[model samples]
Target: MTETVKEYLRIDGTEDDKLLGFLIDSAKEYLTGAGVKGTDSKRYELAVIMLVTHWYENREAVGKVLGKVQLGLQSIILQLKAEGLKSE
Candidate 1:
């Protein structure tokens, strides 16, 4: 798990084990509270880890990225609506 986050963040070495473990725990807690229903896929788990790590590394970028992600999700919703597909 730490390896995945390290790879995503392009980090190397053994100096950040504690910090990465803490962030991994934080990511898990955050995802649990954020209603991630399943803990099955590695991709999903890695995404949460990457997001938390990104926020930890760059506080300012989180807002911008979040805004862009929200807008992208909104666009997807609109497209689905246009196609008469229901989105929960």
Candidate 2:
């Protein structure tokens, strides 16, 4: 998962491995709290990547990129929830 995220972010170094790991964990936790499961789905992986990218790039309180990523994240979460409901 870290490798996937690094590829998505085009990052190539171990300097951020620790931070990326935390971001990945945080993303998973965030999704869990929002009632999102189905970790096997690509949507879940995408959500994590998107979240990590957003949080990483915007760590300095920059709002410029927040709206776009937030909307996409919300969409992914909604889709994941809808999919979960279908299976239940």
Q: Report lDDT per candidate.
A: 0.59, 0.85
* TM-score, every prediction: 0.59, 0.89
lDDT of 1 by residue, 4-87 (tens): 788878888978877787777765665555445334555456556655666667666642336544454345334433433332
| Global Cα lDDT for candidate 1 | 0.59
Candidate 1, residue 32: Cα displacement in angstroms equals: 0.5
Going through the candidates in order, what is the number of backbone clashes in each? 0, 0
The regions of model 1 sitting more than 4 angstroms off are 59-66, 69-88
**Candidate no. 2 TM-score:** 0.89
Model 2 misplaced stretches (Cα beyond 4 Å): 61-65
Error of 2 at 70 (Å): 1.1
